[model samples]
Target: MGRLFWKFFFFIWLAQLTTIAAVSTTFWLEHRAQEERLAQLGRNPPPSPELRPDGRPFPPGRFLRPGGPPRPGFPFVPVVPLVATLLASLIFAALLAWYFSKPIRNLRSAFEAVVNGDLAVRLGPVMGKRSDELADLGRNFDRMASHLSTLIDGQRRLLHDVSHELRSPLARLQAAIGLARQQPEKLESSLGRIERESERMDKLVGELLTLSRLEAGVMGAMDETISMDELVSDVVADARFEAEYIGRTVQYSGRGEALVKGNAELLHRALENVVRNALRHTPEGGMVALEVHLDASGNDVRFAVLDQGPGVPEKELNAIFEPFMRGESSQYNDGHGLGLAIARRVVEAHGGRIRAANRAGGGLCVEIVLPATCG
Candidate 1:
């Protein structure tokens, strides 16, 4: 900021200096010419008034020396052009200053709006040609504003979808419990299914709640910063045991500390889903690998979960992040699509990115990257 201040100040000073110099040079030249003419005429005093070529008489002071006869009783010679030139320079300086300051003023205003949380505010409709860097700046601001608006809109939609899904299951659970009293035998199995459904809904609701809090950056109770090795290792150990018991393998490696600042519980949940997502899709003979490495692109820690399962179509790569957008289902998969959505939200909260893609050897790869703190 200090640098910018001096840069503009110097520019304005230069402009004013140039204008003054040009005006002073013009005045000096005109004055020198007038003085030479006056000096030549004074050597002869114009031959006397009768020697004048015009029939009409000339002004009394027309034949006087350039600066008047250095006598005590001559009218003062007016510095009209010099004063006019100075005035002109003042006008030019004022106009140049205004032309240069207007764009800067607009930029400051837009920056203030951004600081005030009006991410949608943009420097549009700026009165200028679209050929200069300022035009590019205006366009860039507009683009940034547009992207922020889209992200906000996406979040709002995700919230609405989550709320709507949770409400329906909750209402059904309430109704099912009420009916369980009237038909004990018949409602037993129904209640069991309802109980299971209610549990699933409860889990889904909890995951969504965590995702929301992460995205909003609200502090959840019992949340604290923990070591990356501890978190990832715990999840892998627990999941690996379960996979082994289920006749599958959960191979993993997270050597070298990958530091991140976040809620341990929420991050655990996020990581759990990513690992489970791969495990669920992977075949019995197939293996799921949870690998942690430094993300070169983001200069952050990356925790990637790769699965050797049937890959998704290319068209569904990004769409899979939407809430409740589970990829095409199979009889073997009772998939609820909130896993990737929650993963994405949690990672983004830490200024990170997550993505999914098909692997070369016919499988799916999900990568989670969290921003790294420079040590």
Candidate 2:
């Protein structure tokens, strides 16, 4: 019933009417010409009426008209057939117009709903079993809407988590200031507490900014070819000092240079995060093992970190890489839980894959794979 429908109807009806008129006119003109020919023959008497040896004009009418009886004053008039065709064309044109415009109307309605902030509106079910370009368009729209809904939901969740994470340090900073005001004698301790809380806040904010940049895919001029084995060795060396300080141990095993093309800083940070995360979960006196090797295909470098800790649940293995997701174990609840998330994002940004699984021998193993530069 919209303008489009009317346009289609008008054009289709006009075309059908034009065709009907042309066909009708052709048939009518031909019939009129035939009638004229017959009348002319009657006037001329067919060049001397046939005479069969004293025939006397051959019974008056038989000589004038041969074959069957006359057509009885042109019974095949175009008026009746033209009228029937008009009616049929009107019906068919309306139907064809509706068929083309109905899906368009539905699409318009769906667009309006989306503009009104309704992301859940779907056109697939309404389209039934139709398999056409319009139906494909509807499916694409559904996918886009679904992706937008998920992104918006994730942004909202990230905002909430950031606020929650910052609140604790902020509250502690305020409390430390108040304590310093109340007890001038313990000003030094209060100031130290404030400094610690401020550092924690700064670290959290820096991690958040890095996570945002990674999520936005903001890689700037990363044209460096980094050796994976060297990076892992550097991370393991740094982790060894920390592990020794905490009465734990860091063991490293690697082979081959395993060259990859990316930003060295980001790749190093990702590897560090994964290693430190394992070290944090690992118990004192336990060993965190880091291993680097080429995968079976020899097209990518794989870094595996195995830790002796309470493994994540089967369901949470995938979720652990999500921002601010922490394990349920008491030992796993210390940090803000962005380490693995940031690591995952960084690896993914560089066209890599990262995953974690529970070790059969009672621990967790995290693996990071990056595309290797071909020789």
Candidate 3:
């Protein structure tokens, strides 16, 4: 990069030098042309003595006299505009070159940062609005850096989540089988517990695989159209049934025909995860309400599932959508913490966004927004 910078800077300097040299040569040629014109007029020695054979133009005027000796040929360069314009052009070129190279310098420093392992390094303001090819290159570099950072972060999260989640199941299995060998009476219960833990691990792995497939553009082949309103309504109905089975109720309010394109099973799973997550936190008789809003153009729809339960903290709002990020409130929850993460992945696969927030009325609100298909 430094070599490139020096090469680039020298190229500009050499260009300016070449231009100035050309102008100066033109100036000198024009000067010679004027002198040649004088010669052609037979005035090469300039007007000769109108008066004396003396070296003085007139009666040798004293140096202190008011009327001086023939005022020496206006003491000027041969080609005034050429000389002035050449100097002016050189100065203008130098200044313009410096102004243009400022961004390249910033870009050089930013490259140094990236070389030194700083993924966050970005070009300075000089590069942002430049109307040249370099500006586009700088923007593209920033975008590449951004995506690399995101991919690295995602990999880190994946490693951490997978490691932690696997430990529990492996440990449980080892313990269960170990104990089953010694005590026959506890064998069945221990085996059952082992099976349960193994199922949870399988579920987590499945969700991770689904996330990977979604990122790999797997949904590009799936064909399913779902109504956003009915989608939410069905998930809420299931949650309500489960809640009532456990002595709780879910309140649902929504419009109809909020249509979208997506894999119905995946969409159902995303909504079910959200509704079930809300119901899991609330107590008996607590209410979970569903709201569906269609865009005025009906080209989009939003589903908001709100629950009257202890909402997650503000700082955890964004993190909760990330895989394995169990909020402070969910520290004791029994399930693996992939529900919201999977919900986000599914929604995003269909070109949408999902966000969690604290409702004003003391609860959590998970909003899913999806693009709708036009009739």
Which lDDT tens digits does candidate 2 get at residues 1-375? Answer: 899999999999999989987887898787678667777667543454455555654554322255423333323665777788889998999999988888889888988998999989998998889898988988988898899899988888889989999999999999999999999999999999999988988889999989988888886767788888778878988999999998899999998779998898998888899888988889988999989999888998988999998888898999889888886653667688899999998888889999999999988999988899863
Per-residue lDDT value at 135 in model 3: 84
How much does candidate 1 score in TM-score?
Answer: 0.62
TM-scores of the candidates in the order shown: 0.62, 0.85, 0.75
Question: Which candidate gets the maximum lDDT versus the true structure?
Answer: 2
- The lDDT of model 3 is 0.76
Tell me the lDDT of model 3 at 10. Answer: 65
Say which candidate scores most in TM-score.
2
lDDT of 2 at 362: 88
Q: Candidate 1, which ten residues in sequence have the lowest lDDT sum?
A: 67-76
Write the residue-wise lDDT of candidate 3 on 6-110 in tens digits: 555567667766876786788768766765565566532324433445555453321212322232242234477657765776666566666666677777778
What does the lDDT read for residue 255 in candidate 1? 61
Clashing pairs in 1: none
Backbone clash count, each prediction separately: 0, 0, 0
Q: Please, what are the lDDT tens digits per residue for candidate 1 over residues 6-76?
A: 45656766776687677677776776676577567664444444423556654565334343332222333
Write out the backbone clash pairs for model 3. none
